[model samples]
Target: METSSLDQVRAAEFASGGATAYLATASCGLLPRRAVEAVTALAERNATGSRGGAGSFDAVDRARAGFARIAGVDPGRVSTGGSVAVHVALVAASLPAGAEVLAPEGEFSSVVSPFAVRGDLRMRYVPLAGLAEAVRPETALVALSAAQSSDGRVADLDAVRAAAAAHGARTLLDASQSAGWLPLDAGAYDYTVTGAFKFLMCPRGTSFLTVTEEAQETLPVLYAGWLSAEDRWNSTYGPVRRLAADARRYDEPVAFLAYHGAEHALALVAEVGVDALYEHATGLAARFREGLGALGHPAVPGTSAIVAVPGLGAREPELADAGVLVSNRAGNLRAAFHVYNTEADVDRALDVLAR
Candidate 1:
């Protein structure tokens, strides 16, 4: 589709959601119509005993390919996981001993806990302002969230990657909140992790990790399961010594049927084009910030799509009762916007705050 035409379609889709304010893309996103249809079709297929054998294989392959395309990586470099946190832990555990990991001070617990618990690993918490100065030759890894979950502050990835390169450190990004709303340059990092449920508009429990070619050779396998083996399901397979070159080396064997819903959701996002979806979301977020300013609830300076506005010291429950749904983070009301939200929704949310 032409760029303008695609933008118009996105705008119309956002407008069709009606007047209910949905400023929560950071927490969850509204599933698109196509995703809903795909989920239903998958559910029906499962009900009719079409889930196994050749059909299931095709379904799984399509899902992997869809994820790889969105991530801007080769299909062989993508792996499915139950959650982004799980994959982050897996990556952390696989790093070499005595590795020093540099991360933000107030990052999500999932990103912090894995590296913190290792006896041989040293964790350094870099202040947001001093991240560039924290990189050192001893640092083996630099892990960070693409966007700060608390206030939607985006990291300067170019600088971060450059610093890590100078220190001979591998970079890993937790892109759970930024993937669907921003253009991801896969060539810039060693590994990128994301969850499908949040911005990808998929069901919960669907997550993925994209690894670079260098990571494939250097990183050790932390959670190698049957599926991660070279010939996991081959009937004639004897003991296999080599792991698959693909990112399938990170996948676990247990399958969650609900993941089909998440896979279908990701496919829809890919069809819509992530760049277009990101533009729509950022535009809506700008409108929402403007509306919030008019209501005397200005967003924190330098905030991105996941904006945080002061609640005038009101409790979070009070804001919810006022007909606005948002998250409370560090004494601020967090608001998010996605492709399915309209300007009218922002106005309505502001109206609630005005009361």
Candidate 2:
């Protein structure tokens, strides 16, 4: 698709981020106009004491459905949460005592730290490229990010899944960096978690998880609350005779304003289609990566939405001051391309970095 074609989306949905170029979707995505309005509407409703926040459940339900569609899973398989770490903790607690957990080295703390804190579980780390080959018979679970945050190297989902299956180990995929643009098959993994703020372009408090039926049977509903019941109204002030029949059993009380925004944010993702965003963003990333190499900067090589050049982290402040927004991650200058960005945005950042 031509670069001009995406300008309408940038103008309509993302007209407000105060930057000459926004290449920081890896850090946080700018909210769309519709999402801003949705959040404002919810705040006004709350101010008027309408339903005392009961209306949030409707938004929460729609967000759940939107995420289910984005991740290619049934709505019943998805559960709402405020963060990835909490969901990781739940999965971590479900493991057998002293079970060996395998993960990629430098895996995000939200994924690896939960298992580490357990201390009972044996945690093993391998290079991201070798994750599949390292899976052993004794491995109980393989937890990792779909795309690495520090550097945007995407994990090989198929190879890892096949390896885990052969070893009878479960899989937990953190889709935080890949969900909005990268095509995701949440159902293929035993469990998948996403902190949607970064790429899904929602409020910070929104996150989601998908649990397979076999995996669901294994995870204890340790975080159950009123929403955990099949009928929440009946669940109040009781022994909770019937819990949610599906993954909803793991639901937490949502951040009301956040989900209200998420409802619109995820709708925008559905409207654009992940494949289109993938083509657009990766095209911009490739352009930027090529530009960086020509400038004698060595970037982490990949066709990922994020492109990071090492030894250039110190340039981030100067780049931002020049109005080309980006991030510095683990000593690499990281620029994330997203649907809202354009060729001009990429070139503007490149131009600033060249100086």
Candidate 3:
């Protein structure tokens, strides 16, 4: 695909929904043609009953390769799951018992629920601004999202990593909102979790989890399945079963179709280039905010693709009626841009908001 420029991306032959302005990449992204094709091919294989054969289901391997590329880690370090929620639970299960986890209030429930449900652990909710100060001796891990799901505000990852390091605490990041839209250093954190359905423009039921070397050695495997076994195909029914030494051993059994779709989605992201995509989306968001400002519906300042406009919460239906699609968050309207978004879409949205 010729995705070198925004014009090329806007005009590319892809399967973007006919929304005047989608602006909801934060919720769910439109699937690209490559991803669609992958799913279609997988369906064909399944129809012939050929998908269940050995080596026929290479989707998991392909999807892991995609994640490894984005995370700057070896494919062996990558794990897959049906959803980010499942990955979160796996990571939580690996933590040392009785360890304290520091997290922010109002975090995405999936990110909080896994730790909260751990009876052996304690969770301390702290503001993002006070995260560093809240890290204490008992803090074994610190968790937060790379981007705020509500307002699209980005977290200072470097600072957060430093703070966690100072306290000898491992950093666990939820990168679901930022995975395809932003550049991520997965190896920098002790563990990183993300899904492909959002910015990656893949189907649901595909999530990636990356763990560092330290995390691999210290964390215990609470959940085990044949797919994650050291010898996955081994018919060993004994009480003593061996596990894979890499992070892949922690993966859950996910649908092969999800992996097939994710492989193509990640390929599309690679073709577009993450840095270029981020710059283009950010530029579009800035222009979007500017247009709204001229229309007396100013967007909040943000570096992410999401632009939040106050007082538009009640007017969501009104905007939708005029062929605009956005999400309501924290009493604000969140219009999120993506690689598929164009200036024309922004203008269409602006025209509706102006009314």
Candidate 4:
């Protein structure tokens, strides 16, 4: 597509105000105008209880199907959830008692907290650089985010999978940071989880999990809600029933209205094409890095959309006063880029840092 055509399409999709340096994608993405419209339509339906059951069900199914396509998995393998933390709990609870779960140090707190609280499970943290050497036979599950939440470092999924396989470990990938900006093949891992609010441009409180066929039989369902069963509407009986299949087995009750917004966001992404979006986003990051370098504020090595820079140990508030919105962790300023950001935004950020 021509550059002008692509820019026009992106502008149309971006509904936010004047593009004053939006570097907070790691926290939450700027919702597109169409997504806002979809959300509003859903609200209107819910207001009058006019959201037909069949229509809602179909919308939810299509959202799951859209997530499946984006993750390169079968629609039957995708399950809906409210957030990444919920999915992590599902994964942690599914493991056998006393199983060791291996993950990278500095992983998102959501992934770490659940495993940490499990008395029967052992939690192991390996440095991101040393993951290949850390997998062991006793590790029942090896979970890591495809992109580091702290520094936006992209992991080599193929290598991680190979290492996990060598140790007979099943792998779960948190693709929340990479999904809409990178090509994710669900076949590469046993389970993959992602939140729709970031690069997917959906509203908050929306997420999905996909499980490989090999894991469908082995992984346990921790929180089996009414929606998870084979016949969710069947009110017959004594005890609650387990879901019949993989995706359905891990399902939970969620607002189909929220899912409709997510579906619209995914459809917009599909129209733009993931490969094209990836290239655009990466290019923008590269430009931001270059601008930061010129301002003597270069990004940390291995940075991508999420860039981390050195900051005064406790003086990060200074940057905030300068009109540059960024988050700090352990004396590092982390800035994230997305499709909504532009070269001018990078320049503006550089100007703020320079001041």
Backbone collision count in every prediction? Answer: 0, 0, 0, 0
lDDT of 4 by residue, 1-355 (tens): 4557568876788754553566778878878778788878878766777846323767778888888888888899899888788888877877878899888988988877777888889988988878867888898888899898777888877788898999899998998988888888987888888988988888887899888887877667776766777777772364466565668768767766678788888888777778877877788788877877887776777646777777622434665665556667667777777777777676767777777
Model 1 misplacement above 4 A: 1-19, 44-55, 235-241, 254-256, 310-319
Q: Could you say which candidate leads in lDDT? A: 2
Q: Which stretches of candidate 3 lie over 4 Å from their true place?
A: 1-6, 9-13, 16-19, 50-55, 96-98, 236-240
CA lDDT, every model vs. true structure: 0.74, 0.91, 0.81, 0.78
Candidate 4 local Cα displacement, residue 289, angstroms:
1.3
Count of clashing pairs, candidate 3: 0
Q: Estimate each model's TM-score.
A: 0.88, 0.97, 0.92, 0.92
lDDT of 4 at 63: 85
Q: What value does the lDDT take at residue 349 in candidate 2?
A: 86
Question: Model 1, poorest ten-residue lDDT window?
Answer: 51-60
Better of 1 and 4 by lDDT: 4
Which residue pairs show backbone clashes in model 2?
Answer: none
Query: What does candidate 2's lDDT look like per residue over 1-355, in tens digits?
Result: 3456566777788775545788899999989999999888888887888865446587899999999999999999999999999999999989999899999998889999989998899999999999999999999999999999999999998999999999999999999999999999999999999999998999999999899999988898987777899999988886777999999999988798899999999999888889989999899999999999898997899899999898898899999889888998889999999988888898898888787
Ranking by lDDT: 2, 3, 4, 1
Quote model 3's TM-score: 0.92
Which pairs of residues collide in candidate 1? Answer: none
Task: Check candidate 4 and list the clashing pairs.
Answer: none
